[model samples]
Target chain A: MERKRASLKFLVTVMSNQAASTPAALKHTPLNATHRELSAKMVDFGGWDMPVNYGSQIEEHHVVRTGCGLFDVSHMLPLDIKGANVRAFLKRLVANNVDKLQVSGKALYSCMLNEAGGVIDDLIIYFMDESWFRLVVNAGTAEKDLAWMEKMNADWDMGLTLTPRRDLAMIAIQGPNATQALNHALPGVDSITAHLKPFNAAAMGEMFIARTGYTGEDGYEVMVLAKSAPFFWKALMEAGGKPIGLGARDTLRLEAGMNLYGQDMDETTSPLESGLAWTVDMKTERDFVGRAALEKSEITQQLVGLLLLDKGVLRGHQKVLTKHGEGEITSGTFSPTMQQSIALARIPLGIAPGEEVEVEIRDKKLKAKVVKYPFVRNGKVLI
Target chain B: MSIPADLKYTPSHEWVRVEADGTLTVGITHHAQDLLGDMVFIENPATGRSLAKGEECAVVESVKAASDVYAPVAGEVISANADVESSPEAINKDAYSAWMFKLKPANAADVAGLMDAAAYQKLVESEAH
Candidate 1:
């Protein structure tokens, strides 16, 4: 009502987070050698020197959308928590219910939280068993998540070992032909991962195969020994996996309507207002970290999916206006699948999925329609 | 890729070919298409639209991001390439040949102010360093 929109207090974390940005103690995945061979443009992302692009990023995007593109996602940290009461500790540590992950190897996407109910990070937790759980969190949040988990694990008397798997590297091969490429790339991998359902994972020695991805496609997020990453990458490339960059990775995930940990929702925002209300199980009696804050607070706005019908691309931090109120785009991009611009905006409630809103692109306000997120999936347009 | 020796260029990265008809064909240079990545959508000025030098007359969106193509000189759009809008990737495939629009220059002599391919090549090289 006052002014409809502004950047959700993300700057505080990004600003105060001047934690030694130096290259000290930095590590690399095995693909680091292969990326150099391809002459990639490397940049420091969350302390890992990763390739931003090989050469042509747009072509790489198309390669993934139309065929297959492989991404070096080893920067994301995987933490394995073990010992008894692991499930009980996680139920209190995260905003999402751990009870939903009843089946073995089933993964649940959730937001890790601090005591104040603010999001510490968003992660995917694989429920392997009562004694074991694995969490894949953002690269930037690795240190913070480990610290938080360690302190809490000790405080709660949970005999959990928060082991960071530095020995591992991850590769995400996504697009229409994703599954086929991976199946053919790694010898004996298909037989193990051939029947894996969505969000299901299987471990084969040092390699862990998960049928999940940020891209709106049927793909595998394969984690393997850091030493074997280069060989696997080469094999996958020879088997027809075109190497993609972080640029395409952003577009792919944006089009897929997935929330980036820091960009879309952070410590200042709640899962309810961040379009992740469905991920929170209010129906269950279980009380998680952020439950009280979410329960007591009056949610003023909600996150929604948008499709730009105008001539410009919608970008993050851009303002969104509706008759109900104004909001801001958290993540936006020109969708390869839709061939139009799309975004995820936090707008006031009552702006339902079929409504129209205006996005301030440059100086002009362009029309955009609120649609269900996930502009594409499995090479098909859903919006 | 080598920049052609004869064509004129702009900092925004469009290449202009002056024809005997005093008309000009404009397209983004190879360097631009390479930097921008896979072309997905293109919007050119209408045939009759008048534009000032440095005005945004066309828009090009790659899989990575969107960029504006400016009118290199004051001119009236004489023709627009519809084929490019239909198959935007053609620009990435061959940027020089995928001409975006044609313009009848406000003054044919103003082309002298733009960079020749040799100078533009040096500009591109310097920017890279």
Candidate 2:
């Protein structure tokens, strides 16, 4: 398997000399100082100085799954689109049908694709009105997504105003007790958020709280003004909400069967082969950017889940030895919830669940089992 | 940061306990576990395996990544700690007490070449800056 050179791989390497020489070159989130005060281990995550963990990543993962944990996800950008032709523009821009989001606070997950049926970025769109839609995009791909959208807007003459909300800071409070913790942290929020369902959001004062999270847990992704973030983070911590970092976030998302954009699927791979075919709307005849290419191409590989039966931790770039052919692990981690190593591998078709495969870890070939994932959900092990 | 004064140390962060039998019990220091985070898996060298000084013999994996645990000095592996391999979190809980492997040193004088607590502490402080 070919290992892609990304920040995730270098998380373990200590670059003390480089950090000393150019400390100011890295970008900081609003809670950077607070993270340092909390003694978080900060790392360079896609040029952003983000916390990998405050203490134990496994503890943070358990806290998010069992109790309450807060994550400073401000690195993710929220873009606001406003125009009379917004809905029409979205239909052509995204691979999923935006019309499905009828309720004002409802959200839809979609992949923004390139012309050759490859994924550009996977984002969440919140429908606020006929003319305005809010999009939350990944941190590393925010600028690239904006550039592509701008080029498309110019070509289509949509007259839409794309406003990137860099002035906001996002905090994800997740767990089974997340709602109660949020109530403890920011009293009287339940009045506005009590009835909120999955994929729904509400505006309370200046904060936009969404009942959504990357971790497979009940939580809210609250976006507040950048200046108010530190105070919000402090309040949450005071309410017994542990501060979780990106290390736990990666493991949580991987166990939840969610794809990491750069690791799982990128500009070179389409959603069909990336275990995201359900999100790609093909039932109705709507021509999106990559629709024609997807129709013309043949999908040969499939993304599936793996459970290591042996005693080693599964990791990205490991080669998979399947009966049909060779495959590569896209995202892998030791699942704190499952107490075992789990991963998502792109393998050939016809590989069914319950089948055994071998993953080459270092010099040893470890036994593993193919399984359907979301290996964990809502603090419970599924497969 | 708790480097027991009596125990010897290696620059790579392994701590050694000189048993009554002159055999050495070795484990990664507390600082090593702090940097590596919670231990999820550990692969120790076989009991009979012989090792050279500074040879990478065992593997220790945390949730974030894996690391190599090297042999502190030239020695034959006297015994491996089975407790650590099955329950790796013991190392995170008490790094000093949860030993990884015991080694029978080729020469007792080789342990003298390793760092003392005071010298290892100085090396750690320098790395911090």
Candidate 3:
């Protein structure tokens, strides 16, 4: 607990500090004006002027888990890969097997790795055809991912054209009633999306709707023309979709046990230690970019979920003391659904689930328990 | 924006209400809670703890982050408001009314040394820009 006695002063100081920094222009999503109209508190997130919340983040979080909530996820880049050898290029480029995606509109979650087995970015690859695939990657890492892909294309001599669709806007509507809300908003959408399974997608006119989301709930990530985003958002709101923001987005994802690219894993962290071993296809003899490095490296740390047994909210960067060794929290928050504090920590491998550990909060060490993740899914607490 | 004219204030945004019994009541201002947003946890100074002026004595955590509550004027912490500790949201709902601790001032004149409501309001206005 580093006492931020001057924290109120610090907030003012930070705002003043921003003046001294090079005032690089922040990018805006297509729904920027709508967010302002809704009285959203906007913040600079990875150079994008995105909404952190409408008013109350916790209330917005409940709206998503219980009813329906919409998020403007346009900052996430969508790249369309088209060529005869697109499948071949992806199989070599990503850690997961692109060969798994045999049917059209099927999605695969994979970590695009560096040669050193570090995660460059985690992405969702949607196979449209043998010659075409679409990848949705983290906003902050989009440039680096594209550069890496271009490098790989040149090196492999694969004539795939990677087209970044910046002309599009994406909105994710999520919750238990998401599908119904979406159907109500866009009549006849139920018929098209009804048969779609998890991790599947379909095209409806100019829109590409994926039955996928960051929040652990039934939803669609719909990509539409940028100009039509405002109208689409309004329609969804009218159909009972509450406008959620990034603050709630974070709490929702953390409760779902999903990994955030920057916090849960980064360039220096291996997927093996980052709770992403499943995404790394070790069974296949097919060599990928980081195959040799992953095979050669030994995993020392493992990511696990934690539930605080005592008072106090858990937060990122808190130190953990276990019998085996010390660890650190990757991401932590008070789960609005659980009414308790939960965290994902990277600790020594020997620490198994159900074992008790101590987490340092402020100066006091409080007791906590190691548990499996996905703490809450489908409005139910799992652990 | 709602600074009680009767209370004294600190540059750190804490409010001090001088009680008739020579004990002083303390809490964060409404402006402080508004800036912090959505209080989740609060740790008040333990009862009977002696403190110097401006000491980092208590802690208030919002969903966004944690912040320390400094002692406005040096005193002995006579009692802590357990209600604020358990239901931190009370502070966010009404920061001025949700007092954190009762302090027995070491020097009663020290309360006068702190800023009046008008001066504190001016400071807040300056900070906003």
Candidate 4:
């Protein structure tokens, strides 16, 4: 059931439902029952029966903005890196400078590469130690990610170990009072996660609490044991945390100008063009996978944020018109906080910030301005 | 779920109200808004544009996804609720009050063709099973 160089493997047991194994019928988080109890609108996201919204997505979007909302992100995959020379192996595997990981609980977001410049998956590497690092990857590409990591490990002379922790579940509580909500729900969590800054993680026995999230708000991403997931979720909800779904998640991330993995970029595209040039540390001397490919490649287009001027919503796969050339909108949404439509598009490199372009939305070419991303950060709308 | 008995409905989940001025006020039903989750952006048909019965006239994009708001009957667009365009969430707050647009019927006969509120309610119930 295990193969070399593969980072993901589903211990596929003979399930009665064949469709369940397919992406269309993916598994649900432990909180599915709780979500259904709250009358959440359920949708099939990458095969999982995930909640899109609990009644009103816009209101839930505001909850995360003004208050706190909890999301069941257990569908994401977490891989543990262990064994001798694990740090050395990762330096060759990821695009970012892993050597910069100096602290024990620091987290670094980087793109895993395929050696050909294409992105395998954008992930967060928690620098625990020299012998051990942890990676949390997207749910849809977990299988392929595991396979690639295993294959890369096989070629190395150093002893390495990779383990996917599927028995755990992840939940994120994001908002201004996110930490307080968790502290209220579970006793003693305040001291464990109180002083933790953004992009840092702390381990409290069975729970791995990371102060990181897709939403542009102060939050904690907790990875807990599967058996304890339902209890923790219920406790959070009882402690004033709204059980938010994927619907609010999409809006919150969009308002923050963060990119969705599959929608923004995939294995077929490169980080240089996917609004993630900052994640790729090319200035450092440390060579990584796909570093050579990126050095040789010509970046024809760059990802730029779009602010819709007309009365229309910008959406993905929509055609974009610019003076240099045509491009496509990678991700877009009606920002709840900004109360307007915004998007991120792959346009010609010459489309400078503050430049105006047109986006083809619903057969109408609406005007929009190109701007720097992170539209809303830390509860403030910059653009 | 407030299904106004004064207005008629289409199986596609749009509601139509016949005004004394001979124009029909159109809006998505409460059930429709509930199903769509959260209203975000709406694009009503342009004024003076003619639409056939069951025509795709307007678009209602909820945060969940985008869906077409079918014209309940054939008509010429007379007026659009521009305010809803700016604050689409109003529909979720009060679906009946937040009419998307108003239309002058090309054929008043098509108004008789739509299902009454009670009949429309039955259709909504039947869709579940």
Q: Residues B1-104, candidate 1, lDDT per residue (tens digit)?
A: 88887689987688999999989999998877765667777878988999999887887867645667889899999999999988888998888889999999
- Predicted model with the maximum TM-score: 3
TM-score of chain B of each: 0.98, 0.97, 0.98, 0.96
Q: Candidate 2 lDDT, tens digit per residue, A1-383?
A: 44332221132235332233254788888998999899888877898988889888988999999999999999999999999999999999999999899999999999999999999999999999999999999999999999999899989999999999999999999999889889988988979667999999999889999999999999999999999999999999888899999999999999899999999999999899999999999999888999999999999899999999999999888999998999999999899988999999999999999999999987789999999988999999999
Kindly report the TM-score of the first chain in candidate 1.
0.91
* Superior by DockQ: candidate 2 or candidate 3: 3
Residue pairs clashing, model 1: A58-B38
lDDT of each: 0.82, 0.90, 0.89, 0.83
| Candidate 3 stretches greater than 4 Å from native | A1-6, A12-24
What proportion of the true contacts does each candidate reproduce? Answer: 0.15, 0.29, 0.29, 0.27
lDDT per residue for candidate 4 within A260-342, as digits (tens), equals 88888887888999988989988878888899889999999899999999877788888899999899998888888898888
When candidate 4 is compared with the true two-chain complex, its DockQ is 0.24
Model 4 residue A25 lDDT score: 53
Which prediction has more favorable lDDT, 1 or 3?
Answer: 3
Runs of candidate 4 exceeding 4 Å displacement: A1-25, A157-159, B20-22, B117-129
Q: What DockQ would you assign to candidate 1?
A: 0.16
Candidate 2 TM-score to native: 0.94
Top candidate, metric lDDT: 2
Note the DockQ of each predicted structure.
Answer: 0.16, 0.35, 0.44, 0.24
Displacement of the residue B51 alpha carbon in candidate 4, Å: 2.4
lDDT of 3 by residue, A1-383 (tens): 35423465576445333322332477888898898899886777888888878878889999998999999999999999999999889889999999899899999999999999999999999999888899999999999999999999999999889999999999999999889888988988888878989899999999999999988988999999999999999999999999998888998999999999999999899999999999999897888999999999998999999999998888888999999889999999888899889999999999999999999987889999999998989888999
